[model samples]
Target: MSVFTAVTEDDLARWLGDYAVGRLVSFEGIAAGVQNSNFFVTTTLGRYVLTLFETVARADLPYYLHLTAHLAHHGLPVPAPVADRNNEYLGTLSGRPAALVRRLSGRWLTDPTPAHCTRVGAMLAGLHLAGQSYGRRQPHPRGAQWRAEVAERVLPHVGAEDAELLRTELAWQAQQDFDALPQGVIHADLFRDNVLWDGELIGGVIDFYFAGTDTLLFDLAVTVNDWCTMADGSLDAARSAALLEAYGDERAYTEHERRLWPAALRAAALRFWLSRIEDLHLPRSGEMVQVKDPNEYRRILVARIDGEARLPDRP
Candidate 1:
């Protein structure tokens, strides 16, 4: 959910009614993101997440809508879009195109253990397997892609050492074999906040705004980077194992995938590190949001690259 914009109840209810599957009962704002406004909406029929698009590319939304629907159809844990009576999935609400999705049940896990890591890994793998059947790919955006957003936004705001380390990492990444990784659809942003948990089980995965067709293993690497890397730059063995085993359960890896895994993990770490730094320096329009420190992940990435960290053994 994007929290950068202001959304009022009456403003949403009026627009929401046009596309709601049932009579609108109540709408409450959920302040938790930097790109879109979200509301926990209730109706005579069920609960749903009402989103007001604030700064998405607009034309690219169908990918998220269709992808979630596809995942739901394949029996993955994702909230499907609640269609209007006319079968319209996307509708104009408050002058912006919006959609209501079934609110997934679960909470953002505050304490993620190794077992949770494994479950998350498995869920991602299942999603990746399901995504292979999707037949569309959005054209790569022109100008700055997210990978470069760090240097463009954050480096200028901090100490020179941070900037220098980030720039060096970016240059090093530019020389890596990005295309050599396994290929398929990827959920580029599946952080802890995105995965909902019910006790030890992952109830659902939310926030598909960054879902796209990319390297399948790269997605796994991304998950491992987010869910397995610790604050002190060490890869937690049990957590890493859990995640890898979870992913392996859905999509078995090839020799090529195995060979590229380590580098991909390093690459994924750097990707988020840069994005965090970018957000720190370039504050988007939002009421003060807490931005994570990029240096932590930068240290994590360096440790992974230097063989100072080890991902758990996978068969």
Candidate 2:
């Protein structure tokens, strides 16, 4: 996470007064991501991740914080947001809307095996299942509308070939009836880096800022695109099967979902490609900011259009 808002030790020590998590022991900025300002906060009681919202508005904060709490309450391995003395999960620190959640154990896997993919698939299905009862309803921040807008915004910054691809894909996706598919709250950005693993088990899932109401199949497609893809942007069959099979065990996919799997994969790839291009061309100024290559997802979008991936059969 980028450090958009820098907080001094003195600043954090004072902010800790409103919480019951004891005195602040130490705090450091997280530098891996480019979205929010994140810090590894250590207090006398335990470890927590403090996030200062950068793009997310203060009013829309409750939907994310409460969503995590809701998932944690349902026995998922999500980090529970810590409520302050005032019984609120959100707080203001350093003039930015912020939140703190108990940091769970383990690290995100960089090179995940099929077994790992299986666990992620199962957990994702469980997440969608648990989200059925969530009280809040927010449209996915990077859903269809955002895709069209962002693709248009970034087209002028790219070459002619990429611009044509964007236009073609945008038109194709517009004709899709994703709203007709099974819908619910989805973890729209369930990439490999977001899931922490403790040995054979998934320790925790983080970064719920992108979670919202969307097609459950689209969510699965997003995960598959990240966790099951290869260096050349091709899908690895073993990992794909492991993940989709495990997911189907929990909530079986309908025939309609199966029929639309290829299009959904293209939709997922296009969204991330648009986002990466936007980040690369129209980036925000922040401490330790990282902008990933837009070309990686660009290759994936092309590969998906070539029809290289499909829902794998269960063993």
Span of ten consecutive residues with least summed lDDT in model 2: 306-315
Give a tens-digit lDDT track for model 1, residues 1-315: 645555566776676666645677887777665557777888787889987677676788888898899999999989899787688777777677788899988898756898888788778888888888988886322112566764666666878886777677777767766577666678887888889987778788988876776777667777777787777777777888888877777677776677767767777787777767666767677643557777788888877777643333555
Q: On residues 230-308, what C-alpha lDDT tens digit does candidate 2 reach at each position?
A: 9999888889999999999998888778878999999999988888899899999987898988889888889888865
TM-score of predicted structure 2: 0.98
- Against the hidden reference, what TM-scores do the models get? 0.90, 0.98
Where does candidate 2 clash, by residue pair? 1-33
Q: Relative to the unseen true structure, what is the C-alpha lDDT of residue 124 in candidate 1, on a scale of 0 to 100?
A: 85
lDDT of 1 at 218: 68
In model 2, which runs have C-alpha deviations exceeding 4 angstroms? 313-315
What local lDDT score does residue 155 receive in model 2, on the 0 to 100 scale?
A: 87
lDDT of each: 0.74, 0.91
